[model samples]
Target: MRSHEHAAIGALCGALAVTLLARGRSFLEKLALWTYGLLLSVFIDLDHFVIARAKTGSWSYLTRAVRHPVWAFTEQESVFPDVEMKLDRLASHVLIGGGLVLALRPLSRLLAVFSAVVVYAHVLADLLREIEVA
Candidate 1:
């Protein structure tokens, strides 16, 4: 799936979560949660550069992204047509997300649970994308 697709799914899932779990929250709070979820889902793909570098032992992909920040940021799927998709990095993404939830747990249990829910939504979107790609 493309970046836009990920953003779409993330937005949908985030909104659903806010509606269900944040039923009594203010509109602004719900919006903030939705935004947080959307950002996590979309920006999670930024780790592809590290994965690509590790696998190919080259920085060409990173360089391309750096040189074409706008294209890389907006049309990421098309920006690296020569490079292989980094779908294999899902485990690391999930692991990092779990750590985030654990780290946030001490600060606020509600926030930690909310973060977990959003990350799960992100994982679900990625899983569906992987299945579709396969």
Candidate 2:
């Protein structure tokens, strides 16, 4: 999916968190949930940078992505298109990242649940996208 799609989903997740869990909560608690939802939604995609760095043994891919944040995922041609991009899928869209979020329940149950939902929603959107190139 595109960066705009991610942002849209992230916004929606934040809104949902505010609607479902924010009522009657303390200001800080509500703020935390809202912030987590938005951040975690797109944060899952950070696996792309990690995988690129690990496979390339260089910081160029990561730095370019960080610099051209919008173009990293939006463009058809990548700076390192030949890299093993599928590593990103295994790292984030699968069970491992979700498990990590689940583990966060010990720290804050609300954040754990909200973060899980936001991440899952991100994965669902990616899965549903029309993959013309695979």
Candidate 3:
């Protein structure tokens, strides 16, 4: 996708986050949710970078750190650490997603009461695939 599209999507995400925070949730809850998203985004980006670098023969800083002798040696034992980590990641995502949805539920209901059509439009737009033309 183009940078502009990414920016627009990011803006929409930020607005949705802000709206949820402002309307039905406490500032701390909003902050925590936002932080969760921030961390999730970082992880997603890290994974993306890793995959991209693997494809193109480049390295991200974090990947490089993992390649360093100390870190690589430390991580060598973990081929697969059971299902606990996977379950934990799944639980965290579900909790964050559900929390955000619940926080916005009141606002969404109120919007529906007022007949607003744009309530979940951002989310729909976000889910739509971006087809980039070469």
Candidate 4:
């Protein structure tokens, strides 16, 4: 899926998160949680750069994407083609989400759960997109 699609999904998840988990939070607090969730959901894909480094021994794709943020994000399929399914590894999404949730747990249960759910939602959506594309 495109980054924008992930973002739209993130936006929806953020709204749902605020509705479901932030009951009793002040408006500003709820807004903060929603924003955090959305940002987390969208940025979790940054792990792909680490994965690329491990597999390809360089950050060519990451740097290219960074250099052309708008085109890289909007034209992701063209910018980051996976003709051979080279980007199919699962560790990036799963491990990063797990690690983040573990790290955030001590700070606040709400933050931990919210991060886990948002990451899970992002991964699930990506997996579903993979399935559809395959």
Candidate 5:
């Protein structure tokens, strides 16, 4: 997909996220929805069997997990050498997750802020993928 196409999809996802938030759902519910979407996206990526796609999907999953306090304690391990290599490339994820957890007033607020960040990250990753694939 083109960068613009990926960005468009990101925007659409963002809109759906906002709509879910607007419908009187609790912040936890919104966070759950974001987490589920991200995980589902990863499952889709797994079907493609591309390293770049898998990396992007993994980052998306980590970002979502970082947003939810309940998921912060969870540890994800990969047996694949390439996937394990990418897992080690997560210094920024650690820093961002720490900062978000400290800065937000409540766990829900952290999730809300992180949801926006995750959406942007997905778009950027998609743009990078477009450039590489082109």
Candidate 6:
């Protein structure tokens, strides 16, 4: 999914956290939930940078691709068409990231849950878009 879509999902996650999960909580709790939700939603995509580095052994290509996915997508066919897309390897899209959040929930239930929701929502949105394209 695009950045805008991830942002929308993040907003939704924050809204839900404020309205449903943090309802009746202290102001600070709600604020934390919303803020964490928004940040985690987009931050989860940082996994792509790691994946890109691991695969290509450099960060420059990942930075360029993140800045311009269309160019990268087209270039993939010309330069490395034989290579398969491995976005699915991102920790954010796999159970490891969620498990880490869940494990850390003991530190702050509200923030952890909100962060998990935003992360999973980001993954779900990307998966749905991939299915649509397929």
Which candidate ranks first by lDDT, i.e. highest? 4
Backbone clash pairs for candidate 4 read none
Q: Give one digit per residue, the lDDT tens place, for model 1 in 23-56.
A: 7889998888889888877887777777787778
Judged by whole-model lDDT over C-alpha atoms, candidate 6 comes out at 0.68
Candidate 5 has what TM-score?
0.29
TM-score of each candidate structure, all chains considered together: 0.81, 0.75, 0.32, 0.89, 0.29, 0.73
**lDDT by residue (tens digit), candidate 6, 1-134:** 55556778888878876787787898887777777777777666666656656677877756677688787545543433333454644443566557857787888776667666777777778777778988
Question: Where does candidate 1 stray beyond 4 Å?
Answer: 73-75, 78-87
Question: Distance from true position, residue 77, model 6, in Å?
Answer: 13
Q: What is the lDDT of residue 4 in candidate 4?
A: 76
Cα lDDT of model 2 by residue, 4-123, tens digit: 678788888788877796678888877777776777776777777667777788889878877886787678357568786653664456675578676898997766777777777787
Which residue runs of candidate 5 sit more than 4 Å off their true CA positions? 1-6, 24-94, 105-134
TM-score of 1: 0.81
Model 6, residue pairs in steric clash: none
Q: Which runs of model 4 end up more than 4 angstroms from their true locations? A: 82-89
Model 1 clash count equals: 0
Ranked by lDDT, the better of candidates 3 and 4 is 4
Better of 2 and 4 by TM-score: 4
Q: Which stretches of candidate 2 lie above 4 Å from their native place?
A: 67-79, 87-91, 130-134
- Candidate 3 vs 5: which has more lDDT: 5
- The digit string of per-residue lDDT tens for model 5 on 20-47 reads 5546777776666665445432332232
Model 5: lDDT to the true structure: 0.46
| lDDT tens digits, residue span 11-81, model 4 | 89988978998899999999999999888888877776776677678788888888988887778667546
How far residue 2's Cα lies from its native spot in candidate 1, in Å, is 1.6
Ranked by TM-score, the better of candidates 4 and 5 is: 4
- TM-score, candidate 2, is 0.75
